[model samples]
Each structure stands twice: as structure tokens, then as C-alpha cells.
Target: MEEKKSKFPKWLKISLIVIFVVGLFIGWKAYQTFMGASVTDKEEYLYINSGDSYEQVFAKIKSLDIVKHPNLFDYAAKAMDYKDIKPGRYKLTPGMNNRRLIGNLRGGYQEAVKFRFENIRLKESFAGLLGKNFEADSTAFSAILNSEEIAKQYGFTKDNFFSMFIPNTYEIYWNTSPDKMMARFHDEYTKFWNAERTEKAKALDMTTQQVSILASIVKGEALHVDEMPAIAGLYINRLRKGMLLQADPTVIFANNDFEIRRVLNRHLTIDNPYNTYRYKGLPPGPIMMPSIAAIDAVLNYQHHNYIYMCAKDDFSGYHAFATNVAEHQVNARKFQKALTDRNIMK
Candidate 1:
């Protein structure tokens, strides 16, 4: 015979079990509602405009859909007193809880925007690029960039100030002022022109600005990096001979038209000082932003007697060097024929 078992009330046992299950469900829901993952798993970003209020920031956040539970986020924000909004680019990641997200927005913990610019041709275009990347408007950037007084304040002329910004990967704040941006550019420019580089420019009897100008032309002409030194050397030879640069790229720049693929005889007749065919020296300024390789090529140009260059007959993008104009003409005919066959006529 089994020992007699004491029986509890069925209603009481069922009540206890119900209470235990309800307690666990409540605890889990509270944890998730308060401190669980609020941000989404997908890679998303939120850009807060300057002068945005907390409500405006919230609106933008909701628009981005980076948060999983907006109601939970709102409660967390209220509890944490996250009322202040800091303007910047916020890189949202997965596994970010409400506290972390709110703290990131409130404390201005922003990710630096990595801006790697292309070989820009105009300041207007550059300003637009900055506008797209930063919190500032394009008009604001353009106003300061084009201002002569501002340029002079930074020890640069209006014409040559464009060279201050080296085309490279720059990590900068999204809310940087135009003045501060220029200051940073100047600082970078100073750092780039180290003692050795300055001495190299001095030995070449050229200022850094002049070197940049020439580098821009070299960048314009040479499609391949390896060809830069030779093209630079050829330009130096032309300069020594007091011959006009006659660079087709410069002619294209002079016409204020970047669409001209083939530099025609008519394009060379432009009276602008930037037209190297009409002008005897480097243009009033750079035709475009020069690459570091092109600038270094100018500083360390090859020593050669070759004075002329033409693109190779094929699609190699390499130029054929010639010590004499006749040889240059022969190479030019080959390239021209190739161009004609390819229907690149402008």
C-alpha cells in the first residue's frame, strides 16, 4: 500500500501556476520594453540637421526606421531626459539598446563622415559635394569659399585657394563650419609640405602653388599614373624652351566646358588666360584638383630631352614620347586615326 498523499486544493495549485507564468511573462515584457534591442539590425544612418529640436530628431529617426520599437524608445528617452538633440551623422548598428541609442543622440557621439572626393574641377561643384556630405548648405559653403576676404584671412588668394584642399580621404565632422573647414584644409596643406618636400620645390625653382598648378595639368593629361613623370618632364622642357604649353586640357578648361572630348583648333583659339595655347605659362590656376601622385611627379620629374607627347595609337592610354615635333606629329596622326575610328570626334 502507498503512503497516503496530502492533497492541496486544486483551485489554489492552479492559481499558483497561473501566477508564476504571468510573472515570467511580465518580467520578460518589461525587460524588452525598457532595455532590449531598440535599434534595427540592418545598416542604417540618421542625419540630424542643425537646430533640430528633439521632436524633429525623433521624427527623422522614425523616418529612418532604425529603431525596432519606437514606443519603447520614446519611454526610454523620457526616462533618461534625452531632450537635447546634437546634430551630426549617426551610424546606427544592430544590438543597440534604448539607453545606448538615446545616449548616442544626446551626448553628440557622432561618427565622422568619411569624404573621399574625386578630381573636382570647380569650387561650385566642390561646395555641392561638401553640402551633400555635411550638415551645411551648399550656398553657405560656396559663399565662404568664393569670398576673397575669407580666402585672404587664410593666407591664400581667391584664385589659388582651391589647391588648399588635397583630394584624399578626409574624416571630418558633419557640422564643421566653413571657416573651420578651411582651417583644417590649411593645416593639412601645411603638414603635407614637409621640409623635404619644400626643399624639393625650392630646388625646382617652383612654389608649391606653382607645382600644384602644373600637377593639375599633368593630372589632366596623363591617364596612367606611370606616365605622369614623363609628361611632367616634357612640360618642364617646354617651359625651359619658353614654348606655349599648348595643352589641350587647358584649352578645354579655358572654354569653361568639360564636355569637349577632343580639343579642336577652334577651342585653342579661346583668349582666356587658362588657354595654354594662347598663354605662355601655367594657367591662372589649376584646371582641376591635382592628385598626390601628379604633384610628386612634378617634384621628381624624369630628366629627359623629349619635348612632345601624344597618346598611343591603341587604347592603352599611354602617351608616345618624341624628342622632335615631326615624330610627335607621326604619333599624333596615329592617335587621331584611332580616335576617328572610334568615333570620338567632337
Candidate 2:
């Protein structure tokens, strides 16, 4: 026999030994690298949207070359317990290996920034806020607010811009246009209107426009939520009595700022239609976007004969309510004294 061929050929035996050793090394490395290191290729950009199934997401990762293999990425994502990722634009970088990449992508790395609109005075401010994200024309926004045609179609005259809107925190997508955002805000207001509020307005012999006007005034006056209904009641009483609302906020609104050291009898005579002190009733429109609390105060106002209120010098945001001219004058004097002491006089 030819030296009895050893049970195994030399090359075959050598190959088997090499294969086992290689397998052992790979196994140890795999065990050591749980959710292993990221790949070191060029960075890739990916836009993942919600509603993508895991397989679909895997395909996107592969197409972007953000991962070396779809199957591996999917397996790692599953192993890492990745699920239900929100869809959004993601900046994928090199070194985002199967494990690291899946973790970051599935962990929701997208950032969100909030743009708040509170106590904003004019339509221009709103347009300006929107301009920070998207190219917006403040002039156009103002024009839209003052557009007789748009206002007429929407049942809101140009004068009613502020009153027609309700102030609230709105989460808008980044980079939204001023015009489109304003339209959306109007839609939100429309959704808030109910038949009960409508009927209440009708019963009070008030139009939505008038109610919003009063609500805006109530918002400007009542720094505290509890005071809104009482303040609203005062305005309502004044309206029922055919007395001028005589609201200083209206004058300040007309003046385009609240810094008027004193509402001299002259300031109240501003020719603008927003001059409620000069007008016989509510202003032509809202002075600010009334909060829901203000709107509710108008709708479910407490029944009262009081027609005046002054801030309680405590700055607790409460007010002093008065039922007669004498009492009102007393409260007003007290508020004036408080103002003098604080040197808030302009």
C-alpha cells in the first residue's frame, strides 16, 4: 500500500485545522462586539419616514450605503430591540456600524425646536416669528390681515384680525410659511367654535365679531384666569347699559404700544376704530388673540352689575371689582397710587 494514505490527506487536515482556528477567533470577536462598532465609510444622508416597515427601513439603509448589509442591519436592529421609529430626516455618519447605526436611527435622533407665540401684539410679529424659519413677507401678512376681500369672505373684517384668533401653543413643522401658518391658525379657531357658543352669542345679541372683541379686551385686562370672567362681566354690563367700554387697552392698542405714561384724555381720542374709549361699544376688532379662558369668560360670564375693575396693587394678578362710579374711582385711585409708588409712570 502506498505507505497507507494517512486517514486524512495532509492538505485536507491542514485546511480543517485552519478553518476551526479561524472560526474560533471570529466567534470570540462576535461575542466581544455586542452591537459592534460602526462602519468607517463615507457619510450618507437618509430620509426615513414613518410607516416604513422594518424591511423597508433596511432597504433604505442599504441604498444609502449607511450599512454594509441589509440582512445584518435588520438583524442587529431587531437584536437591539429597535422598533416603531418616528420618521424624519436623519444625518447618518460613517462609523455608524450595523449596531451603532441601528441604535441611533431607531432611537429617534431627530431634533425638534419649538416656536412659541405668546402675548404677541401685532400681525407683523406673527409674520416675523414665522420668517425665522421660512422666507416670509411681513408686509404680505399685514396686507392679508387688512385685506378687505379676504376678511369679507372669512366674515372677519380687516379690523378683526386679533379678535378672530385664539392664542395657544401651536407645534408647527419647521420652516412653515406665514400665510399658510395663518390659515392653519384660522382653521384651529374654527374647530374650537361650537353651537353652544354660537347660540350664546346670538342670545346676547352679539355677533362672533363682537364677542371676540370683548374677549380680547378681557384677555388684556385679566392677568389672572379667575379675574377674566369678572372682567368680561364688566364689559358685558357696559355693553348692556349702552356705555362706552372705555378700555385703556384699546387706546394703547391704537397707539401701537402700551408705554403711554398716562392715558391723557387726548390719547383716548385716537381716530382709529380700535379706540373703544371713544367708541360707543366694543372696539371694531380684537386687540390680541384671546386665550380660551378669555373666550370662555365671555361665554359663561358671571351675572353681575359691576362695570369696572382695577388691578389690585398686590401684583397677585388679581383685580378689585367695583359696582359703581364712586367705587370704581376709589379703585382707580388706589391703582394710580400703586403705579406712582412703583414709578411705572412713563
Candidate 3:
């Protein structure tokens, strides 16, 4: 049998090669699609804040509905070999791929909530603001404020905590710890105490506590910021002589009740260290949170011989500053009439 010489068509062989290449391409495309689907299915907004663990982070992502499979995030995170990732609040987006989301989570991408500080009574308010979103106890915070142990780091004793806080709107992380938040406040107060402020306090023979005490009085007595400086100067002038700083706010602080719309003669007789109407100098400590304006007013207090001030209902929102008691009484009587007529002097 003669072996027939095989005649192969060149186009047919080329066609087979083309089919193999196309098949390979299709398989690779299908694999890519599967991988993509594993990542891009969920939309979420989440915050991986400080002190969050891997499990906690996974839970948050799941809550955001960004990742359908928490186990996949866990596996990917571990495979990436990240331990103790720096955590921050993050705004997760819809259909974010898993790898990219993991990268963001590990990079400490955070979404910050604006937590503003308001009328706080020393450290308790700080704790309340921060603790509202985190673990914070007001009583424990007050203990730290009054504790010499933690305050030593700021170069002051516990006795100075109340004076150190100046009421202002502060921006802080929603999850900031109580201690860290307090430190931030300490820094703010320290920055406010410039050389000029210190020199001014010294010139007035007032310590930081004394200034804060005066500011608190100004805060309580004056209903508006426009009247703070005048009241501050009134107290300062009284201090220059041997007169008592007879501020009504001190009595309220002593009583622990802002009730008693009027501080009567009997209220002054009650013995309390904070009763400035009875004592000869500033109160032992601040009675309330003082705004920065009040603090500034005391530091740069106006120089005057005015020993008394009474709210003058001239509709100008100002008090009549007087050098003598007789003029003060006349103004006081006029104010008394306004209060009685308005039924404000209950």
C-alpha cells in the first residue's frame, strides 16, 4: 500500500489557531467579571473611627451595606497582613471594590462629625460632648478635673481646673477620648494666656483663678456681652479700694440654684466661700463657664473710678457706671421701678 501524501490546507490550520486564541480571551474575560462582581455590589457610608478593631470594622461596613460578605472583608484584611491599622471615620461609597475599600480602611480614612463645645461647667461638659458618641462618664470626668494626678501634666494642680476652661466652640473628633479632649482644651487655654494677658493680670493683682472668677461674675451679672466690660471694670474699681466684690451671681452659685430671681438681704447672710457679696475679694473659684470675651474683658479691664453699676433700662442694653453710691442708688431705683412695673421683680 502506497502511503498517500497528506495534503493539509493552510487556511484550515490558521482557522484552528484563531479559535484557540479567541477561547482563551473569553475565559479570561469571564474570570475578570466574576472577580469584579465579588467587590462591586454594595454602597455604604461608614466610619472606622479610632480604637475600632477588625471585627468592629467589619460590623460597621456590614451596617453600611457596602460589603455583602463580612467574611470576605475579614479574609482580605488578614491576607493583606495588616495588624493594628490606623483607624478613622470614612465615607464609604456605593459599589466600591473590596480591594479599594480595604485600602481606604487601612489608610485611616475618616469622616469627621463637627462636635461643638458649648456652655460647659469645666470638664464635665467636655466629657458629655465627646462621650455622647463614645464611652464617657461625667462623674469620672469630674473626678479627673478635680484630681491632681492627671492635671500635673499641664503644670497646674487640680485647684486650677475650673479656671483653665474658657467656653468656646471647639471642633473635635466624634470619638475623641475624654483625656485627649481635655488636653486639647488645656492647649487652647495655654495659648490664650499670652504675655500681654499675664502682664495685665499681674498689674491688676489678679491671678488666673481671680481673672476667671471675675469673668464668671461678669458672665452671670451681664445678660449680654456688651455689658461685660462695664461690669468687669466696676468690680475692678471696687477691688482697688477696700470694698467687697458684691456680685449677685456668687450667691446663686453658693445656693446651687439659679432660682431666687432676686438676691435679698437674707441671701447675703448665708455663709459660703463663693459668696463674693459677703467676702472681701473674688470668689474662691469660678461660678460658671466664662466666655473668651469675658476673659479678655477682665485682662484688659477699663480703668475707671466707677465703684457701682446698675442696669439702666434705656433700651440701649447698658449699665450706668457710677463713682458714688448715691448716684448708683438713684439709677438702682429707676431700674427697680422698671422691674416692678414689668412684673420682673417677683
Candidate topping lDDT: 1
- Among all candidates shown, the one with the greatest TM-score: 1
TM-score of each: 0.89, 0.66, 0.76
Q: In candidate 3, what are the lDDT values of residues 1-346, reduced to their tens digit?
A: 9987558778888998999999988775543332333443454346556677777767766676666566666666787665666654555665565666677666765656555554555455665645565445566566677788777777666655677776666666545667887798798888888888889889888877778878888888877887777788889888878798888788877877667775667788879988887788877677777778888888877767789887786646578778888998999888878877777753
lDDT of 2 by residue, 1-346 (tens): 5576688889999999999999998885564344455454654455565477777777766676665555656666777887776565555666556665666566776533345666766777766655553334466566777777877766788778666666676666443455666787778778778788889888888887788878888888777888788888888888899998888788889988677855667787689878887678877777886677888889989888888777787767788888888998998898888888988765
Please provide the root mean square deviation of candidate 1 (C-alpha atoms, Å).
3.2
Q: Which 10 consecutive positions of candidate 3 have the poorest summed lDDT?
A: 31-40
- Comparing 1 with 3 on lDDT, the higher-scoring candidate is 1
Checking candidate 3 for backbone clashes, the offending pairs are: 43-94, 89-110, 89-111
- Relative to the unseen true structure, what is the C-alpha lDDT of residue 182 in candidate 2, on a scale of 0 to 100? 71
- What C-alpha lDDT does candidate 3 achieve relative to the native structure? 0.72
lDDT (Cα) of model 2:
0.73
Model 1 residue pairs with clashes: none
The runs of at least 3 residues in candidate 1 whose Cα sits more than 4 Å from the true structure, single-residue gaps closed, are 1-26, 41-43
For each predicted model, how many residue pairs clash, with residues at least 3 apart or on different chains?
0, 2, 3
Put the candidates in TM-score order, highest first: 1, 3, 2
